[model samples]
Target chain A: MLKDMKELFKEQWEHHNLIFRMAKFEVKGMYQIHYLGSIWQFINPIIQVGIYFVVFGIGLRGGRPIDGDIPFLLWLLMGLIPWFFISPTMVQGSNSIYQKVNLVSKMNFPVSLLPTIRIVGNSFQFLALLVVLFIITLLYGIFPSVQLLQLPYYLLSMYMFLFAFTIWSSTIATLIRDYQNLLQSMMRMILYLSPILWDPMGDRVPDWLGNILKLNPFYYIIEGIRSSFLGGDWFFEDPIYLLYFWTLTFIMLYFGSRMHFRFRKDFVDYL
Target chain B: MAKVEFKNVSKVYDMYAKQSDKLLDLLSIRSKKSTKQFWALRDISFEVNDGETIGIVGLNGSGKSTISNILAQVIQPSSGEVTINGVTSLIAISAGLNNNLNGYENIDLKCMMHGLTVEEIEAVKPSIIDFADIGEHINQPVKNYSSGMRSRLGFAIAVHTDPDILIIDEALSVGDSTFANKCLLKMEEFKQQGKTIFFISHSAKQMKTFCDRVLWVHYGRLKNFGAKKRVLGNYVEFTEWFDQLSEEEKKKYKQNMLRKQYTVQEKTKRKQADKKNKWTAFGHLAMFIPLLVLGALIVLGY
Candidate 1:
């Protein structure tokens, strides 16, 4: 069994490029169905930003200020940018196996690659959103700083985090169909729990709750992006947080991979 | 040298009748219980060496699909082991290819699914396109294509994979006679190239022409497996005899067989089926209960 797992990993590694390309193909295939094509990727997120700004920034102006410096709209956009990256990737990633049940059953190939494809496909859309974010931020006078040089590192960390979580969700969701619904609810809860809309640092929450908030990987990731893009600080300055994020990412990846490898052969039977 | 093996394999499928039955069961509105367990295939064992073509001949629900599915690894056997030497491609033909994807993309995706690298897929793409011969329709989604076009594309993709073992389940029946002949020729070429092939069809003549060996599965058991001529000859005789039986004779035979196999529950089920007005009672209750309550309220109106 162990030997089989090792062989599976080796096969997955060798086929990683094919997996990535197929993932890109799946995204492209989605675009092929629509009249507007690739323009939707750019347009969708901007539309999301506009709707949220109107609803939350203007409509439900609850008089809650963000750090007393940043505009509420800007803060919401910053928060939403990461939330966009995380939510869809995780949700779609979780359901990918079930969605492609027929393909997995009929074909003999690496099954782990299916869920990973969801993450990679979503990453393309996320990149489009990033370009839109950059242009919007630039217009708002939130110019690039020296800390902007660490953007690549933050992006890498976020990708790693997304990949890890996707693997975890996809594997578990295969056995328990309800995990997809559970994940959506959890994401909604976490969206409010994390420092996405509110400033964790500025809030006078209890220290115990504050400490718990720091433990969420999204808190670090969203905060990491906010620091680099908004507050202008290098990501690597806090080695402890970086270590925590990487360690958690690796743990999720390891277990997720192990579950996938263990269950893949029997997947068709269940499907 | 054995390319495929099925040893004492059995698959039992638990079939639930429908949601209506379940709802009746939940509401204690039972007519006759409709759920049952069925053994699709049982104690099936066979072996085929490399470079041999074997054909499975059976009627519908005779476990032909179940055997093919097990060989394809699409579903696991309830018991026993199936061992194969190299990559096996089981093209149910109708089941695998996506109708939403265009022929070109379907080819690409199928190639990727079979573990072909992108460059390798690109190298073979032209030949596959040429073989499919649907011309400009290859660029359109497969849903728009005729069933013959779908078969052509499916056959093209399956052959291009260069499988060590090829399993075809009712694929050749779809295309026109010309395309079917072309497909048979391709299979002959693959057979000559020393690949193992399992062909499933209801046509006895086709099996006699194509296969070195014939396997007859009767109600999930291996009824016959040997040289094609002898096995098929016996199968043809048996089926002919079955067809010639008189209605009364067939009815008597069926009753005798059922009597031998039926359980006490089955007997009770038959009795219940004769006695029940379950649906009518439930329907009347559903229609009259509201009216009855309304009439009572009107009589006691405040």
Candidate 2:
């Protein structure tokens, strides 16, 4: 098992350049058919944020504030940016291997790199959305602080967690078509279940249940990014939650790499 | 040293009734075993020395493509040992070219996948384009290329990659005779450079002229393997005799050979069942062990 994990990492590391190049090509290809080209990446997210801001911020919250001083739109933007990155990645990453079976099967290509390519490809759009979030925050007079430096830490955490999850999910989805559908439904469920749209920490919800909801890994990420962007406690301040998140990630990675190496040789056969 | 050697190589494909059953069997949860198995290659073994141009002759569905895929490391055999000494490139029709990417982009991507440095790709770019002869269409998406044009680009990229073992699987059949002649000349140059080549083609005349040896595959088994003169002679004679048969007789002959290729013995079936049971049990264990460890660790609070 250790050897398999090592091999997976080493393969990705050795092919780092190729992965980046492919990711760039994929991001470009996604918008290639459109006359607008890559502009749609930003446009789609901005439109999503606008609708969510209208419905949840104005329609639901009555243009109120979240957690006292933070305006509802700013708070939603922080969570929505991360949520936007995570959502499509889950759907697309799970289908990455099956979608590229024709391309990868023709040569001695590393099938595992497909999910990473998906993540990195979506990161381009995520980065653009992130800049929009930063600009909006700055406009609201939230200057950069030491807490902002932790943004990278949270971003890396999100990437690692998503990588672990997608590696497992993509392998399962490739083997079982039903699982892909399950993943799509599950992502929709998670959007409502997690605190992206509604604040679990609000007065309407009880503290104990909200704490339990924080156990959801996405909750940890969304809350972490919110805290980093808006100036809150250091990530190290919450040792237990930190330990829990990384433990879950490594555990997922363990199972993912195990199943990946075991079944990847025959993945084409399944197709 | 032998450039390529296959020791008792065999490839068996499990026939799944449904995708759900495939998942269940993979997770070791399926109650009933799949009864259908296709043996694409059965206990076939051969060895090739450096610079040997070997031709494979077989009727359709005789597993010639399977051999090429395995040799190219694009697929793995079910059982046996395959030792390949160097990089193997399989140039089938539009094998690795991405249709959405332009011709130049496909060349860059495929060449990069083969580990060519940027400078090296640049160095070979002109020759590949010149050989493919697609002209201004090189900037156009590959989906726009005709079948012949696609194969030309594929062939050009594979040959320029400088693989040690080149397997051409009917890629020449798509192009015109002029391009075919050009490829044959390039292949002769490869032979002079001592690179082993595996050629799979239906044209016996071309095989006779190009290959040093011939491998005759008859329904997943090696019917003959020897110098081109003897093996090609026997293959050509057999093909001629088989063609003279009535259509019904030919169909019956093919069905009989196919039946022999796919049936598994009761002993092997039982063995495979036991192995599946063990794997399923392991799958259950693997599924739970991680959650168990994670829960335990969280409880312990690191």
Candidate 3:
């Protein structure tokens, strides 16, 4: 059943320059037109956190401690940063092929790179959010630590995780369009399920349910971020979750890419 | 000497009478004969020597553009092999230009697509801008440019890349006569450089002036491909005859083209089917080994 994916990788290698340029173009073109331009990168996420805070932090929890000792805003912001990064990143990453049908069909560039372009595009925006996240943490009196370097390690993990997910989501979303809507609804559900707004690890959430929430591969990312930011634990401290996340991600990525190779030629017709 | 060759290259689009047939096809449950097929091209075989200029002439939906697309490697042929010897570029109105990007950015984008390095793109940028001749508007978004200006930019970027085989599909139709002539002069320079040029156009005069040979396609079949005078002469005669046909006769003419066209050639069908099955059956797991390889690499620090 196995084809020479080494060949597929070589093909991707050949188009690395194209992917890099397209990703760079996407990152630049996104914020170039507006008056606030690059400033919106900072404003958009802050406002998103504000709305979540008003609704969940203040409205629901009355702006109190969320984790055992962490304030609601700190907990919420750490969770929300990844949430914001992932929600649109997946949504847009899934739709990247449908949106750039012209480029995929008409140009000589690699169609597989479409998902990567989206992932990279969102990563740049996430970079901005990352800087803001650190700033807010610093303001709250958490001094920088040796563990701060873990941010890049987690960033690489998020990229690997999302890029892998995107390989599947973008390709599958093209074949079965309902996957996009399904994902949209699922993202909403994921928000509730993944401890974005609530204390899934706290006593309010049952121990069994909280343990189950950790099963979500997406939780792997947010938990990694929180662990790094809070200096609670190293990524390898939880080896089972790491293994589970990698297995789930690579399998989805494998299937996602298979769909890409099989259907890439037919995409223009489908569009 | 064969810069490009198509040996029995055919493209058959699976025409689903009902949209749900696509799903059935996916499940491999649909009977072979139950699915209607529309062949965009059939048994197309030709070879273009280095520096040869070939013109493609056909009515709308007659597969002229399809030929250009296949040769440019934009799409794969359904069955048979396409051997292209060198870098190919296709120029058409808005073929690959991103609407959101400015003209200047589009040059870099297109050049990058051609796999040029940063220094290479920098070296060619000035020439492309000069060739396009769109002044201050170059800084503005391409979506704001008119159709004529878009073609100018597309043509400029394509020709500047020094492609070994250049295919132009109806892009010149939009530009003004002066710009079209300017393009022709540039193409002549490419011809002198021993590059293969495929020109697809409705203009007989343009074909006569630019093309050394002509290929006439009719209803997805190659009617004739030879010296421009020999093929264009017959194609002109056929169109003239068609124009004079009475309304009743025209309907019969179309019917005649479709008659005896559905007989499935087992060889081409089997090849396409085998390819489809191979990819669908194990295509996912095909990458299983690669994933394991990547997994191993990731577990390692680097």
Per-candidate DockQ values are 0.13, 0.41, 0.32
The root-mean-square deviation over C-alpha atoms between each candidate and the true structure, in angstroms, is: 13.1, 3.3, 4.8
Give the CAPRI rating of model 1: incorrect
Candidate 1 wrong stretches, greater than 4 Å: A1-12, A62-65, A204-211, A232-251, B12-38, B244-302
Specify the highest-lDDT model's number. Answer: 2
Looking at candidate 3, what TM-score does chain B attain?
Answer: 0.85
lDDT, candidates in the order shown? 0.77, 0.86, 0.80
lDDT of 1 by residue, B80-126 (tens): 88897888888776746766678888998888888787799999999
lDDT of 3 by residue, A125-232 (tens): 777777888898889888776777787877777887787788778877776677789999998898888867887777676666666667676777887787778777
Per-residue lDDT tens digits for candidate 1, residues A1-271, read 2454465457758777777777877887788778999888767777987887777767765645577667787778778987887888889988888778667676766677777788778777777777777887888888887777777788888887777777677877776666789899999999878877666566576655665577678887787777777855577676656666676676566567767777776666554
lDDT of 1 at A61: 58
lDDT accuracy of residue B73 in candidate 1: 82
- For candidate 2 chain B, the 10 contiguous residues with the lowest summed lDDT are B264-273
Model 3 chain A: which ten-residue window has the lowest total lDDT? A1-10
Between 1 and 3, whose TM-score is larger?
A: 3
Best of the candidates, DockQ: 2
